[model samples]
Target: MTNAGAEGEPPLDAESLAFLNRPGLTRLWAAARTRLERGGLQPTGTIRLQNLDAQEREALSLLLARPVTGPTATIRLPDLDIRLRASAVGRGLAATLAELGPPLTDRRAARNAAQAERIRLWSAAETTLAATPLAGQPWARPWLEEIRRGGTLTRQPSGTALTTVTQAIDTLATLFPGTTPGPAPATWGRGELATRTTGSAHGLDDGTLLARLVLRGIAAARGADVPTDAPGRRALWRRASVIPDEVSSTVLTYGLRPRGGTWGEKTLRERADRALETHLTLRELRTLRLNMPPGTRVHVCENPRVVEAAADAGCTAPLVCTSGSATTVVLTLLDALATAGCAFAYHGDFDWTGIALANRIMERYRAEPWRMTAADYEYLATRAELHGTPSLPLAGPQVAAVWDAELAPIMEAFGVALHEECALEPLLGDLE
Candidate 1:
């Protein structure tokens, strides 16, 4: 930099080469550069040179034209600037540092620019969601916070984060459309909802960035944790009225007939007559008729084996099996059955997941907990071989038992999972 142009400083002359290239002066110049750069290239404050060697002191004395002797010395930028301009350097400090290798950067300015860009990104995002139902909801803040914390929004190119936010808000807004306190939106296929809101059929598909973001909002709004598995994800979407295809989303049933002559009712009557099981889809249930009289107790279970057991035992109380996690079709069937004046006796496994399913059924449908209580868990847990099966260890996160408050804590204490199959004999007796 002695002979070449300084970094953001005026070009240096041959006469200043000795001073710019002088030994022991590197530390002073580096400190000055750092100070000025840190101050955003605007301040001319003092820079301290600590533990000065003989060369540094001599260089400083020569540069400042003072008898410098101390181990530390504070050099003022204004003095250096004046000296640099008048001396053979022929320019101020900025240009001089530029002539030196590695150009100076205004770190403060860089930070400010980045911050402004972030503000602009989110402000535009707010404008993007201004018209949606999500704009001012309580869950919106947490969603935005999670997005911010995850760093997904800021890790990409400009405008991309906003695009992501817009997609999530648009998809969510569509999934739960209409004013607050209104009826639930009609269920739609996952792809169809994604296409309508985000212009991509797979916009909200599982494992997609948009899917994760959207699920976070759904969980936050519902005060639930973000779903992690395929079944869990589908369940969350189903709760939001987004469903799989009618064919893919079906509920298993066995026994007892509705009085109506519609396809579902006739199918139920025929299935019950033969003691066979039938799986009903939303499409079929939508058009098929049913006429369950008031107080008609339809049994609901979380596993298909229960329905199988009921069928095998010739138990004809009309069982609906969730087959694991209850799908949208299962929920719709339950709602329809409830509308038709059918009471429900819901049973599930005795593990944490089963308890969760029971909570949802009990909370949503007011169904009675069938063989799903603290007493039932304790009785089943005590016998290693209940219903000819060994008791399994409870796995997964604990869920609150809304139907019976003591059920969750009891299960936690026992650390045993009494599956519905283990209670099959008694359940079969009840069914008969």
Candidate 2:
């Protein structure tokens, strides 16, 4: 039997070896080549060949030194290996197949190498993320999982996309306070921040990998929903006090006095005896150092009309108006004041969005809810409805006044809206 060949047995004649390399053995060689490419071609395997011509059957019959019993038959790998060796072919069947068939690329090994590369890339990114301050934050785990599942760094893949994302994460980590001594407070434009951190001015532009990564981190840190559009993204950056753009953003103020010799101070110093309306552009805000004396109070209002009324009534109290839903400009001014040890008392309209804005402003600046309580809403709302004070219906879904938990239910129950102007006499009365 072909399998009975002893170890180190002399191989068959040279003519037999020459015949094995001929095209006659092509069909069997193709089968062996298929298995080798899939993985290592093992001994003692069977390959089923179909629709074999007379020549091919005769070739197999000769190679195995057995009768070719059927047009299609199972080829045991071990039988083929032993026969090839005993026939004085190259060392074994696999070696002969390589010579007779197209070169094998070892697809299984290629796949394994690709998988290993992917694991290595992810491990590197995770290691960097773990070492950063954002690692343990509320947003880290889900963000990391997204990276893993997507198989590419960030939402889109570019040549440096992974590196860009990692840099953004590291940069965002700098935004939080650390165990060590902290850096002095500083604010920057998005381009300036990108240039300083990643050495590219536009590295954190909208739709960029760095922007996407940092946005996710900020959303997690601030407990804000992830933003999708340009306006939403700009608003998020503004929340972080990172200006999206300078010229377009402005905050309104009156009765502000900072201890400095700048436009903000100069303007206020000139109008020392009376309140002066000032529109502080973001560009101007960046240059001014707000260092109000401790215990100073800065009243924040949701509407410009409140500031106007305060000014009109000769109210000397420092007032800031958000103008609408507080923009980044408003938050920036408020944050600076808050940092300078200025106490804030925030008042807004008695509506759903109004309560929400108050909650955000209060939470961010630690502002006292000025007349923003359930009792306040009930009093103002009841008075408005009774006095025939024409007002918009309390529109939008109800929002909880987290500062005063009882406020939301009272407002929802009243179903009538009241604005700060509605309580103008009382609000101005307190301002003086």
Candidate 3:
């Protein structure tokens, strides 16, 4: 009987032992051995080894001391010839049989399956949140459902009060045990906490988010981790000023004014000129108003060129150009005009872009839409021989909930764009 070595005994030729010393060679032999054990080769009992180089065959022969047969030749090893033949034959048979079976999955199918699973998870979460009863404030149920569905809520709830972060965490945990809530504000800083609270507010304006991000960026620039709800952050922004006056002047100028301050005719005229020359926004408008003259008439124009032309024409009425959205300066000037009781008439291009901008100004500052009606658009469409390049597509996502719903459809129908210059004469007529 051949004695196998004791379990703990070291081999006499430790360096040459394939399984113990050379992991790579041992792995190859084990894989071949497994195929032999599994009956994966061609014949039920015989192994037909192929794809082996002469060196690998010699190694196998030395390791097993077996007789191995391949497609080209049969090499006999004294002790293991039968085993090697069986392993190879089994591997070859399995490969041949697999080729005759059903097809394997392709890449597209795997991707689609993964996407379908993600949708299923998202849908399940939506359904679960919708059904769950929100305690205390019944109206919170819909808002919570919206959040679960990944929709942002900007308006404050008029019905039921909204849930707190702690309550939200609990409710979410019940629905999605796999998810963990993020760290509380105290972990990072007070400023971060304030920002998170403002974001989660059911009644916060959409602009609040933009303001928060801007403030946080400023805090980061100052090497501070700003809290989400930091009063300090707000105060810092209030104190900070933007140069050249155009950017910061508007919000600051209009924003700083007392609600009912009288802006007389003289005040409006002085303020409008100061705003144009200095590019002051609503905020800066407040500072300039202290010593402004009375009973000034402000002329509002859509194009900066109109403002320039008015100035060049020596028109004395205080003039302003929207330049696009009512910048802080524009809003400030409008607000000052309103306070001073100065009548304002606005005019812009008769195209869709003009209509949209007019709508935004009307909504944001309660400014009357200056000659931006459907009639105005139709009249301009017929009169202008050389219209500006067809109104370009809108820059960002359209918020139809607040905007003129007919504007997009009108632009699509016209298939052409008109600029402020096309309607310049009629607008100037209104000014005269």
In order, what lDDT does every prediction score?
Answer: 0.80, 0.75, 0.43
TM-score of each: 0.54, 0.49, 0.38
Give lDDT tens digits, candidate 2, residues 52-157.
7788778878878887867796888887888776755646765565454445577888778766666666777788878876666666767767656765563343
Q: Pick the candidate with the highest lDDT.
A: 1
Evaluate model 2: give its TM-score: 0.49
Write the residue-wise lDDT of candidate 3 on 315-412 in tens digits: 44555678766654566567656776655556665555666667666665555556565566656665653544354433433323133456546555
For model 3, the superposed segments whose C-alpha errors exceed 4 Å read 1-278, 281-283, 290-297, 386-411
- For residues 1-432, could you state the per-residue lDDT of candidate 1 as single tens digits? 435574455456565766676887999888988998888885488999899999999998988888889999998898888987787767778777777657889989988988888888777767766777776576776677668777787777767777888888887777656544132557788888888878888787678888888888777767777877665776777777777555766888887688886666777898899999988877787676677767889989888888888888888787889887866778878888888889899889888888877888888899998888789888888775545655578888889888888988988998888778888888899998
lDDT value, candidate 2, whole model? 0.75
Model 2: pairs clashing at backbone N, Cα or C within 3 Å: 44-78, 45-77
Local distance difference test, candidate 1: 0.80
Give the C-alpha miss distance for residue 395 in model 1, angstroms. Answer: 3.7
RMSD of each: 11.7, 17.2, 18.3
**Candidates ranked, most accurate by lDDT first:** 1, 2, 3
